[model samples]
Target chain A: MFKTTIFTLAIMAPLVSACGASYAPPTQRLADAQSAERSAAELGANSVPNAQLSMKLAQEQIAQAQKAMKDGDNLRADSLLIRAKADAELAIAQAREKGAKIEGEKAVDDSAAQKATNVGQGATK
Target chain B: MNTLRNLGLLCAFTTAAGLVGCAANIPPQDLVTARSNYERASKGPAQELDPADVHAAREQLDVAEAAFAKDGDTQATRDQAYVAARKAEFAEVRARTLQANQTKDRVVAGMHADERKAVALTSAELAQTKGQLATQGVVLQAQAATLATEKQRREEAEKRAAQAAADLAKFATVKQETRGMVITLSGSVLFASAKWDLLPAAQMKLNEVAAALTKEDPTSKMVVEGHTDSQGAASYNQDLSQHRAQVVRDYLVTRGIASDRITAQGFGPTRSIADNASPEGRANNRRVEIVVTPAATP
Candidate 1:
């Protein structure tokens, strides 16, 4: 009977190793997603419609990733976290672009006002 | 023996998997991009122009660095880097806007200061011009007063000269001589023949002559000369002529003329005006002449 138990253990070892090799926790990915979402919000993502939408989607993916982690599905959690991070990056890019455009417009307006002041001063002289 | 060999193989496989899972991941390209962006923004106006945005970017970069340092978290590091890059970009844009506004404000303030200075200078110049005009007015008033005083003095002098000329014409034959004005009085009309006393009519005529002399300039000296005809004895005529000149001087002194200004002289038959052989010539030679000398001005 001992010989038979040893023979069974040898056969199950490869299966256990294979199963253990596939086990990768999504802790880093979830943390990354959360960090990206926070950064996007801090970058004024909520001020733009498209950026706000992207940020909202990122938040939902992060929530789903957390749920998957709790259900003991590390692969699914990692995949969801990757999608969340991508959405957050898109939101950040969109917000920055919008801020840049606004800044450009403000600069143009300031330059025009300065030109007007110069012309007024010349006329006064 | 077969069981022991299988357990060793399982131990080796598990150790290899644990090593792979625990190893630190290499920094991703996104993380590098985020770092580069953060550095560029820090070196730019982000640090001073928009400190709040720079601080937020710094926080994300810190998280990314920490996650990268902790093993087995490549995704977290990459995501953190991506977020940090965007935050850096935002900080740069915000800083640029803030810096531009500050520059524009400074320029406007400088222009205002220059305008204020120009106004102050104009006010100062206007005040100076007003002062100059006031000074010119004062000078013009002083010049006008001086001219008025000079005109009044000239009119007074002309009036005095006219009065003097009219008074001299009244009682004497006046002439402009080298000594000054000469007035001649006939001796026959002034005194009786061969007598030294002046006639009553001669005294009246002498009074008018004294009045005219007094009306002349006060700073003039007079010489009174008495002349007689050649028919009289020299000694007797000299005494009579001296007495006659003394009487004329005495009359002038009583009429308010100073005695020191008159000199009495007797030229008895010595210097005759005409040929003393004829009666009319002798009559002309017997005359009294008054010579006026102007006093020297200082």
Candidate 2:
């Protein structure tokens, strides 16, 4: 009875974990209407998105894969492991980009008025 | 068939011999108690099962009891009953634990679903607030732009007023005072000696200057500064200078400029632009200087 049940369960489990994974670097860009409204108040759009949520999602997927293995679903577990690792790497890339965006925005906000004044005065020329 | 019969005969003879020998540790008289006290070593500390776990748990106890009293060797049968008892105990506990874990897992899963729902609702509300903020941001940006433009217009008007002043003067005398702007007018024209009263002609000229200031910016934020020559004691001159500047400001207020925007200050010979040694330079220093300060662009 144990052998029969184990074999049948293994066969059934393959269908659950068998997946066609698609990859996309998800980005949230503000629409023109939203940007216009934001510009009225902050004089700028929300340039930084929540990158940590993505990292957490990737980490969660990795945990789910580990759980599948412990639940005696190795074939499904193996497939999830690959996708989870890829997502984690994607999250790292997003983190780097987010940091760069923050630095870039600070640079823009700091020098905006001074640069505008200097250009008007013809000091550089 | 003959070999089977001989083997069976050997087993019977052995049992009969064992019945004649030692039989000390048979289970107690209570059938229900014996079953209830079955060894539960295999399942460890997990909960024991309900009566529903096995269909024949009680029936098996009765069967073992009957065998202990009739035909079978008491000691051998008792050992067999105890082994079965341990297995029943383990299975009962194991079944109960499995059922409890399933129930707990279901409750946890339900809570997770509820949390997910709450998160989705919060996300939608956040998106809406962000949208409103974005709209408000656009309006603020436009208002700020209008303010910037107004500041630029006022600055241009000031430049034009300065050019007009230069045009009005047949000989434009532009002197950079060390302290600030100091315009010199004769004492006879401004006030009578030993008296604080301003002359009618001098009041008219000062009004014209104030009108010119109004032309520079309708919002004429200015300071009326008065100075005195070192002809008297420090305290007297300070008081006299302050009185004169206040007089000038009051006259300007009557002319049209708002009182809130203008400030009257008196520097009584403390700050001298030219040497007090010469009469002409002292006269220049003694003059009432209207210092025009620029407002913030914001």
True contacts kept of each: 0.00, 0.00
Q: Estimate each model's TM-score.
A: 0.45, 0.32
Which lDDT tens digits does candidate 1 get at residues B134-235? 999999999999999989887877675666556546645678888888888888777888777878988778877886787677889999988888886998
In model 2, the clashing pairs are A37-B134, A37-B135, A38-B134, A39-B137, A39-B138, A40-B137, A40-B138, A40-B139, A41-B137, A41-B138
lDDT of 2 by residue, B1-102 (tens): 999999999999999878765453344443334466443422333333444424334455556667776745453344335434433543454454455555
Interface RMSD of each: 6.1, 24.1
TM-score for candidate 1, please give it.
Answer: 0.45
Summing lDDT over every window of 10 consecutive residues in candidate 2 chain A, give the lowest-scoring window: A25-34
Give the clashing pairs for model 1.
none
- What digit string (tens of lDDT, one per residue) describes model 1 on residues A1-125? 99999999999999998798565788888888899899999999998997898899899989988888788777767867876886787688667767766665665566567557655755224
Interface RMSD (one decimal) of model 2: 24.1
